[model samples]
Target chain A: MKLKCPTCGREYDEPVQRCECGEPVEFKLFEGEPYIAKTVWERFYDFWPVEPAMELSLGEGDTPLVKSRIGRELGVRLYLKNETANPTWSFKDRGTFLAVSYAVKAGYGAVGTVSTGNMAASVAAYAARAGLKAKILVSESASDEKLKAVGVYGADVIRVKGDYGRLYFESLKLGEKLGVYFINSDNPFRVEGYKGIAFEIAEEITPDYVLIPTSSGGLFRGIAKGFIELRESGLIEEIPTLVAVQAEGCSPICRAFSEGKERIGRFENPKTIAKAIANPYPPSGNAVLKLLREFGWKCLSVSDEEILEAQRKLAGEGIFVQPASATGVAALEKLVEGGGIEEGAKIVSILTGSGLKTLATAGQGNARECPLEGLENCVSF
Target chain B: MKLKCPTCGREYDEPVQRCECGEPVEFKLFEGEPYIAKTVWERFYDFWPVEPAMELSLGEGDTPLVKSRIGRELGVRLYLKNETANPTWSFKDRGTFLAVSYAVKAGYGAVGTVSTGNMAASVAAYAARAGLKAKILVSESASDEKLKAVGVYGADVIRVKGDYGRLYFESLKLGEKLGVYFINSDNPFRVEGYKGIAFEIAEEITPDYVLIPTSSGGLFRGIAKGFIELRESGLIEEIPTLVAVQAEGCSPICRAFSEGKERIGRFENPKTIAKAIANPYPPSGNAVLKLLREFGWKCLSVSDEEILEAQRKLAGEGIFVQPASATGVAALEKLVEGGGIEEGAKIVSILTGSGLKTLATAGQGNARECPLEGLENCVSF
Candidate 1:
């Protein structure tokens, strides 16, 4: 499979996670007709760099594209691509499944990832499914409660006591030496796997814009490539305007984009309730910045207040997602208020993970107490 | 709109939660061919009692029936009907969606349910989607942490300080008087909604046996009706043998069945890690017992140790589920050892809910610590 660096435009024949210039590499655009199949992987059979291990699949992709009532209030036709319905209750499973498939095929006995939340659990689960050893490297600050989900999958979780950013690059170097396939965020195959989200969204409706909650910029880049491939394959006539959303606390890409900077600098002391998307120095920030500038795409950052408000709003509509997942909706409100998006335009927001993962951050439900004898009085309200 | 009591054989022309005899009522057998449609609600259109609210759907049901490697060791072909993939990460969403649809159509402004776990969350989510106020009556012992998932859906959660068992009946009585439709466990429409699981399973593979993790017995009864209707519709030649699996700590239905009793007695001090299936006096226990006797089906109860072991085993297969969801797998092992099931018999185990919901009891992951500078040595093993 041919992979090319979006930022440096360097091509590589073999599968490589990043370029010599230290930028994430992605597979070249794939052009092929869609086929009738049960899963998105099979439907877009011609797109993936490696054969997806169907037996190892935990029903990751093909999540429900739920129509939202909030859309009417916002003067837009909104649809939520509920990725929380995935196996591990996150969008990471899509990438994990594809990357694990490649790892298994390439004769790697183990798979590794540097994440404490969704990706760690995803890789561990997939590795267990594929009967591969998994070394999950998490930051020292990662909570034991958060690691419980990952540990249950029988992965060897290691809390690396050092700079978290350096650990990402260090794990990759160590994994390669130890024959552990490191499928970190923006891994070439992992990014390719995310194309399924775009493919599934297109299958339902052709929207004017798609809002994605960006962290390490892997998900945004993957979706962009997916739509680009679909357009090249003659699947869709026009590409939707892609919007990269980030928390105001840690928005390196948005800051760089708005400042007209080609390269992104690390944001110091990143802190937000949306911990899943709170990456200070995203590995693929340059690649995402290049895509945004080249395509005239937008990058917006939402405040914690706005994110929590959006999360509550989504919950009101029956889909409760993590604070990070709510950033898309938060950004949508800003875009509509500024008239950046036309009225009645079709829009799709990507909900990246399940809210259950971050229960501590989810605001209380205002539960009331009642005695059984006084139930009648309680029921009256 | 025909309803019949499975135990008493009493008939009702209008929709009712239960019979005058205090047994859970169910819809009469619907005989119609499956149609080509997108959702299970549409595909099995002829099966449901009320027209499903398509616009209010959060994409519940039609979960993946994953083929398992555990079967190879058991000398039986095993498949896991992953209901954890449902909208609320549990099978309750299927029933909640259908019941809420009926509630909305019947013009009920509010809906309520008596549950502290999956059902509470499911009802709250659907009620929010249907624009109906939800009164989730949870027990006094229900943790606020657990309720956060339910409360996030903007439901009015009430911790009723009284006998948890009596609250179920009280809610229904109060709900009807206050124009609040209480879709509790075994609500006719809720049970009817579960038919989608059977329909989806049949579509994938016609198993020789189906294992259900039984608690309130609504799920078991719903599945039984689905298979029986499929057989009556001439869709399948034979109905698979249905097995109701329960934890030894609280197995009223199994205890009654084993004793050859006509009715189930309340299990005292019911305690188990599988809290989701710890219903001491299942509302539909008598109904499920009757089905077991009529069909000569099996009712097995496993220990807490076995359930935890099964949960670990499932996690090893990359499908981490709650303790209650693992009971089916635990029972499968027991049945295999006892030669209760034939060799190479096809078995489908229902994984009822997500493990993330019960993280407190999920046990700890063995996470080791390593410095980032020495990460190369940590990953070597």
Candidate 2:
């Protein structure tokens, strides 16, 4: 496989860090199979040309395609691929697992990431499982609750004092010098693993559109790539219109999309309950913008209130998702309110992470109790 | 199939309610394939059972049973049948689905319950799904979080002002007058649904032992009966040992077992972080107590700190479980620590519900973030 620059159509022998055209390169997919091949260790196997050591996987390709009853109430054919049910509790596991495998095989001494939710947890766990050192960069504002969550994985958590946005980029520079392969934010290999989610989605039902919560745009890129591979493989006739949902408080993609611009500028004053999708400036912004333009895709944004409402709606239906995860549903709601999405349009929303990872944002719990002796004061429902 | 009470030999015409003998009648495992009819309404071909007209299904059954990489760390093959992964995020859905089905079939306009965690969410959601009303009773002190969780399910959240313990029995009396079907703590029919978890476990692997978090004891009893049914069908040679785990603060079963008694007297002060298992007086206590003696099973009580540690361990492995759900792991630690669980024992620990449902207990959401402009003053993690 070779790398192609979206800007100038320049190709490279290896998946290059940057194209001769001065644009970032991505793997070019001719065709993809639903079947597993030589383990990830086999660069011998046909896979994306993302440069990394091949880490072996246990066929984490096929996740379940759940037909949710809750989606019916929301007026859509809602399907949850249940990425949280993965080896780790979020879709990042898909990317992290693959990235870690490659990084390990590439002989990286340590694996690292900048996150506290699903990605941090996922990277720490997979690195632990693979017997590699894990260095996680988290924000000082990251909750103790989430800290304990990642801490349990035995990863060396580094709580930095600075803008999380800057910390993300800083980690890569620091990690490169420290021999810790940052398997996250913009690792092209991580995007490759995300393709599995799309493959799984394509397997069950072809939808008119697929909504993905966009953070650093790795998942959006991966899912789009997965569908592309499926189409090239002749498995599916056409790609689902991929929509990227960004938090309104931090919507560089939406801003770029609205302006019909080819590139995304950094977002400032980003704020939203969907923290996972609250990237002020995603590194894959240009790559994502190109893909969106190529396919006539839409980028949408939603408010914190809408995200919370969606979260409540999903929880009402018994699927608790973090605020960021609710972005897909929130975008759907925006489409509904704007009358953009046609009724009965077959839509698939990716609940990227479980709400359990961010229970704090929901506020202090309301579980109540009375003294055992206070039984008589009970009232009617 | 008919149920015969072991103490009085009294039989029941229908398995929906308790036996006239006053013993919660157990299912008589008949000679047949361990099959329960589904109510998918044409889409439902294979299922557990639903009495005609009782089509209470929210796509609750047929949960996934995935093997655990975390278990390998302990030198034992472990599988987590995430009942917590259900619609209401608990195995209680298995039983609630059935109970609500029967309630709907019996021409009940509303179903009711007094619950802290899974049951409240399950009954509320399934009730809504079944086109029936859910009236959930809880003490004023019930965590505002859980109330909101069940409240999101659109259940009528009845905040009673009395002792939470007696609310369970009180709800039953009120249910009778209102012509509503109260899915009692140990409704015989509810137990039938819980059997589905056992069936799932049996299908995946004949586990050497099944550890269930014991509270009202409905789940423990149902699982035991499922294994019994399997044995009767000659599907398995023996039934796995049914191990029940309780929080040390409210361990009536262990207290009874320790005294070699068949019935449990209520505990006085139930102080445990595992509020779900801190049921000083569990209604199904006597029934589970009887089973423990007859089946020679063991009941272990664990401290709240231990439960929290176990919860962390599971989360470290990408599982977020309610504090109550972690009691099983806490018991496992005690079993292993006490030399009760032998090496290489293939163990299955049931994580009953999503931890997101109870984050307040963990003192989460402690950190706050500032705008990027405040980066220089950012707090250190």
Candidate 3:
């Protein structure tokens, strides 16, 4: 499997997570005909760097490309790739399933990840499924309630008390030394796994644009590569305009892109209800920036209010997602108003995770109280 | 649209929620060839009583039937019908979607349900999608945190302060009077919707036995009808032995079945960690009991401890589910020990809902603290 650093143009014959220049590495574009299979792993059989452990799959990919009513209101055909239907109720399961397969095949006895939310739970569950130990390293500020979902999978969750930014790189270094395959946000295999989303979306419809909620930029890069591969394989005529969306509260990548900067600087005091996508200093920020500049793609950020509004709107459409997942929809209105997207363009928004994970911040429903005797009147308009 | 009461053998020409005798009504056996379609609603097109609103679908049903490792330990081949992968992260979405479709077609401006958990969320979501106002009548004791998931779907959540049991029947009566279709547990269309699970399972493997986590008995009855219809349609030779699993804390149906009683009595002060299946007086209790007796099926109840153990075991297999969802797995061991199931028998257990729905009761994960400097040692064996 040939790997190359998008930012530095350095190449490696062996699978590597990052380049010597500290940029995330990615697999070379794979060109192959699609196969008739139930799972995306088998359908895009030649795309993956390693054989996906089918027995270890939790039905991660092949989520429904649900047609949305929101698109009609905006004069565009909108479809939501509902990733929340995944095993762990998040898009992370796709990457986790693939990365864990590689870890198992590579003779790693354990797998590790530096995440407190989706990735941590995903790795823990997959590691348990593979009969391998898992060392989940979380930031000191990670809540116990949030960690409960991860811990239930029997992973050894260690809350490292130090700079959360340093924990990502430190865990990788320590994991390699300890023989623990750390599949962090932008791990090469993890990014490759995300290609399934793009593949699945293409299977349903050829879109003019695809909006992705970006954090560490693994998902953006993976989807970009997926479409790129599909085009190279003569499957699709052209790659859709990929839009990288971020929470305005913590949008380093968008800030850098807007300022026309090649490199991204860390955004200080990152805070947002969309905590899942609130990365101040994304590890693959430069890699994503390069892709955006090269392809003339877009990077936009949505306000917390807009994100919440989108979350409610999606809930109205019968798909409730986390605030982070709603960013794409949140950015849709702005994109339309700004004339960045055409009126009749077919658009696909990737909903990244389940809203149940962030119940505390999800605004309360207008629940009225009624005595049983008065229930008839209470329910009446 | 023929409906029949299983208990009283009374038939209705028009669609009705329940018989005059107070038993849940179900659609008569539909004999038709399965069609090639993406969604189960279309695949089983000939079976449904009303036209399924395809535009209003939330991509429910057709969940993965994952092969399980736990079955190996029990000397049985196990498959988990992961209903948690449904739109609302529960099997209720299947029933809710179908019932909501009927409600919309029948020109009901509003739909309602009596549930505080999965069903409430499912109904609210589908109602929102169908553009029908939803009145989710939850119990007074229902947690605010749990209601957030349902409320997010823009449903009017009504916390009725009275006997939760009576609210079910009351909602139906009030809903009809107010032109609000209440798709309560065991609504004819809702039950028919659950047939998709059975159809999907049969498509994969003709299991020797199917384990259902029984609560209100709607799911069990629906699945039973699916298999029976499949057999009648000559799709399968025979129906699999259906087992209704329940928590010891609130097992009215099991208690009645074990006592050889025709009717089930209300379980006094029902309490269990598996709140999802804590229906003390299941609306379809008599119906499920009759199915068990007629088919020579089994009804087993496991303790809270066993349910928790099974939940952990499933999590270990990378499928974390709620306590109610784990009941089938929990009952597997007891069924094997009692010779209720044969050696190497193909067993399919229904994982009814997502674990995130009941995180408060979900046991905590063991998280250890480690400083950044000591992270390596902490991660080391």
DockQ score of each predicted structure, in the order shown: 0.48, 0.13, 0.48
lDDT of each: 0.92, 0.71, 0.91
Q: For each candidate, what TM-score against the reference? A: 0.90, 0.77, 0.90
- Compare the candidates by DockQ and give the number of the best one: 3
Model 1 chain B poorest 10 in a row by lDDT? B30-39
Looking only at chain B, model 1 earns a TM-score of 0.90
Off by over 4 Å in 3: A1-37, B1-37
- iRMS for model 1? 1.7
Local accuracy of candidate 2 as per-residue lDDT tens digits, A1-90:
788888898888875698877778888766731223332223213445554332334223344445555556557776666555444557
Worst 10 residues of 2 chain A by lDDT: A32-41
Which residue ranges in model 1 land beyond 4 Å of their true spot? Answer: A1-37, B1-37
Residue B297, candidate 2: Cα error in Å is: 2.2
Q: Chain A of candidate 1: what's the TM-score?
A: 0.89
For every candidate, what share of the true interface contacts is present? 0.80, 0.20, 0.82
i-RMSD of all predictions? 1.7, 6.5, 1.7
Residues B46-160 of candidate 1 have per-residue lDDT tens digits of 9999999888899998787788899897788999999988889999999999999999999999999999899999999999999999999988888889999999998989989
Off by over 4 Å in 2: A1-89, A104-109, A128-132, A333-343, A356-381, B1-47, B51-76, B128-131, B304-309, B315-320, B333-343, B358-381
